[model samples]
Target: MRCAARRCAGRRRRRRARGGRWRRPRRRARAEEGRGLVRGSSTPVRGAVLLYGLLAVGAVTWVLADRGTIDLWRHPEPLWRFPFAAGLAGGLVVGVVFGRIVAWLSRWAVRRTRWGAGLHEEFHALLGPLPDSDILLLAFLSAAAEECFFRGALQPTVGLVAASLMFGGMHLPVNKRFIVWTIEATVLGFALGALFWAGGQLAAPVAAHFTINYENLHFVRRYRPA
Candidate 1:
């Protein structure tokens, strides 16, 4: 009877020891989880600060340098004499379709990667969708301002490849998809820069930019659940 009692006490002690061990690990795990949540919460703010800070610096430098603000003054030189508005309306229609295509591509790429879905989802959530009017205005302003800085002034002041690099870097703040996004922007930047240099006016890139946005924006947003 005494041996059985001792065995029972030994089993109880072992269980208590095991319970103690399990408690520490669970506590530690919870603490680590809390830390992870805190880090995740701060990442977006950090990303935003980094991005906007870069853009602000770029804008300030542009203002101080007095580079190509006159390009903004150069209004849209539509083909006034051509039949059917010289394809202005048609070009814009194409741009809308193009924008949707790019956005769709971005969504697919982002969703497929390991860390990409979070970046893609958060980007859309934070920035929200660009309204039709806003997209139009942004395309115009971006074509003018961006062209002035990147293509007109910077390319001539610097060089083609160098200007494209800066242009891509400046967008890195607003871009979430990292290397892929940068690559896409770089290609577009090179083409847009080339067009601006060739045309000596913002019309071509502006139309193209707006068209791309119009095309892709709809496709990207199409996936959103009703």
Candidate 2:
């Protein structure tokens, strides 16, 4: 009778152990789910701050450098009267080519899949609707600031690749957004860099960037939903 009682006790103990193990998983799962919620909820705000902050910092740095107070040593160049004009022409050519390629890729991709759809939606959300003045201001500021930073100072000393990476890095850390966008921005950065390097004038890339942005803004405003 004692042996049978001990066997019953063993069975009860095993049941209790199994119940405890199962209960643990439930608590762990709840904790994991809560963590996911917190991460997901905070990602967007964090990403925006990161991206916008980088751009703003880069702009401020460029502005300070331009004023000669921050004088980060850059390659000295002989002043040429025609550098501005040359840069303007060369920048336009490069901008047109790059713009066409981007547009074609966007068109080809947008019709085919969910990824394209999401890209389209995101693109529209970020830059689809704006007034003429807003477009002009955005184009001007972006052209002036980006050209000054990437093409003017960084590209001359660091080479095209480093400048490109810096430009891309400055646009970083979007929520679950692939680094591919950063790379793409880098390539665009390089193109502008090349324009400045080849033309030997900051004005060229700035003009080109402004023109490209204006066209892009116009196209999106016309075709995409707000």
Candidate 3:
């Protein structure tokens, strides 16, 4: 009887150990699931905020432009000098090419450096798992609003270099990667500013901005880890 009782106790211990092993994984899965839910729920709110903020900026820009508060075209080229169609086409090409080059460089840096990799991951985390349609709309709105304000209104007043620097500075959130992001934004601003200066209209910079944003977002959505 004593031997039988000892054997039963050993079996019970073994069963508990086995149960614990299974329960740990289940608990971890539940925790991960909960986190995912939280992230998913917050993405729309972020998107909405971004959309509205861009819209407000665009509205202000439009009002200023209408009121002659800002000169979008300082040089005031003849209509024949920078034809809308030609400007749009050239801007599209430049944007696509520049965007691809930047994307390639980013991929290379991510692979080669820990800092690059971390920044890449951080960006993905901030974006979360937004739907493709929402991302597309966000991209469009961002391009339109930003170009209207930055290239259209601010660039003419501040000059290209100052405007580009200001654009970069605007991106410098109080974060670990503030410098890196600011530098990146500065470089992009230079490109867009050049487009605006060359084309002497909002169409060029807007087209370029839209193309770059659309491509970059799509790339992130498609290539980022599940």
| Stretches of candidate 3 exceeding 4 Å from the true structure | 1-80, 224-226
Q: Give the distance in Å from residue 23's predicted Cα in candidate 3 to where it truly belongs.
A: 24
Q: What lDDT does model 3 reach?
A: 0.67
Instruction: Give the Å error, residue 95, model 3.
Output: 2.5
Worst 10 residues of 1 by lDDT: 73-82
- What RMSD does model 3 have? 7.7
User: Which has the higher lDDT value, candidate number 1 or candidate number 3?
Assistant: 3
- Summarize candidate 3's per-residue lDDT along 1-226 as a digit string, tens digits: 9999999999999999999999999998665444422244356536555664775566466647655554443225423355667766766776667666666776766677776766666767777554655566666777776776677766666678997998788777557854676788899899878867776666656666676667666655556532
My TM-score estimates for the predictions, one after another, are: 0.48, 0.56, 0.67
Model 2 TM-score, all chains together: 0.56
Local distance difference test, candidate 2: 0.61
TM-score-sorted candidate list, best first = 3, 2, 1
Q: Quote the lDDT for 183 in model 2.
A: 66
